[model samples]
Target: MPLKTVNVGLIQQACGADRNTNLAESINGIRELAEHGAELIVLPELHAHSYFCQLEDPTSFNLAEPIPGPTTDALGAIARELGVVIVASVFERRAAGLYHNTAVVLERDGHIAGTYRKMHIPDHPGYYEKYHFTPGDLGFTPIDTSVGRLGVLASWDQWFPEAARLMALAGADLLLYPTAIGWNPDDEEEERQRQWEAWIIAQRAHAIANGIPVVVCNRVGSEDDPSGQTPGISFWGTSFIVGPQGEWLGTASAEEPATLVAEVDLSRSEEVRQAWPYLRDRRIDAYAGLLKRYLDR
Candidate 1:
């Protein structure tokens, strides 16, 4: 299964405090992307609601919605109408006492393709995600979609190359991340630039290493914590699409809300992999340190 190019649509936008407004804006953006020749559209993490990680409140759990509930139904409808595949981040209410930060894929035919829960749930500082989401039990896997096998992961999961490798092993052609990451508004300019650059570099490296295209869609704008206890995160928009060899195809601005599109050729993946041969090497037999939490023994 060679993917030479993949057309990617990244929706970067400033999130509002209102959930309905955010979802509506996302829908409109998806429509616009489709109109502009985007076969697949990806939205930022927790786009339907404010990045609730800003605070730890029991009431915040109320934002979780059932997977096949209203949200999916609406998304499925949109996928069908636009005839485009969609990757959307969601706060999933798995059961009465279980929840996960999940990425849902809607195939072009309007059916629920598959889903990947967020594997790395960060619970540090302003990003208090573990309070709201259970770590993904499904492991690293790609969803089968009409456009392609989507290697969809959540915000924190993007940092790990192991996650991307597992998806590539599962025959993913495109890596999709629905992310909401930002710096503490008080950070020095240098620190902010470093964080943003590191993010883009890490994902592009994944594409180069795995011989697959990477699409990262992030939320823009600033959010203030309702608790007033901490300065909220200032989300760096900069949504991007990078080629298999770490080449930049297109990128959104730092603060603008836009539906960014880039055409991809899905047939080049096999070519790149053949030339690089990174995956075919035999380090698998000796590298067992990855399984341990730490090499404390």
Candidate 2:
């Protein structure tokens, strides 16, 4: 089905030590964006609490809540009131010792449409996700929503192309990434620039290669290590909306809070695919190497 222009809101903000304040701030941001004609709004990953992964304490598990829990209940009403679809990322406490990073889609009327669990959990410094989240077994499935198909993924999932392609193959018009990526405060300026560039370039390549719009909602500001273990990552707030052809509709600056609105002409996906024909001319018959654990022989 061909889609018309869809307006998206990228809520970029820095998290605070208070979860209530952060959640309230994010909800307000979404409503404000909706007021400004944002039909679909996406917020940063785990926007509720501070970047809790800064520490590895079992007590931090308190930050994890159920999907229909407090955050959804609050945000759903906002979506229903504004009649806007919301792509919200949260830390899910499925059960004791069973937590997952989940992205829940609330349709325009606030109905719980569906969800995509974060497939790739990262264990790098300042981001100890693997310590808490069990890697998602839901695979790479796109959820259907009132606005359009929402291809949702959490922070670490943003780097993988296979995840994006699977979503595109499953009929995703735009890829949504609720990310919590950043540079370490201690890193040199040059190293920080290189890391940030790599993050943006990788996602752009995903959009260009998959021929789909990519929207990433990333956090900004410097989070102090609550656990005092590793320093927190200074989230570069370049949350962007890239076209199927990888054109930047709009992007946020690296050190500020802002609401970014981008217009997506969803019909261009078909046009670009038709021109490149990359998906059509694929030799899927002989690409079995991709499934192998390691092709090193």
Residues 1-297 of candidate 2 have per-residue lDDT tens digits of 656889999999898878889988998899789888999999999888788887688888888899789988989999999999998988898988899998999999998898888889888777788898999988888888777887887778888888988888888888999998888888899998899889989899888988989999999998888767667678899999999988999999889988999889898998999888878887899989999878997
Relative to the true structure, how large is the alpha-carbon lDDT of every model?
0.88, 0.88
TM-score of each: 0.96, 0.97
What lDDT, from 0 to 1, does candidate 1 have? Answer: 0.88
For residues 30-63, what per-residue lDDT tens digits would candidate 1 score against the true structure?
A: 9999989999999999889988877789998888
Cα displacement (angstroms), candidate 1, residue 117, comes to 0.8
Q: Which stretches of candidate 2 lie over 4 Å from their true place?
A: 1-3
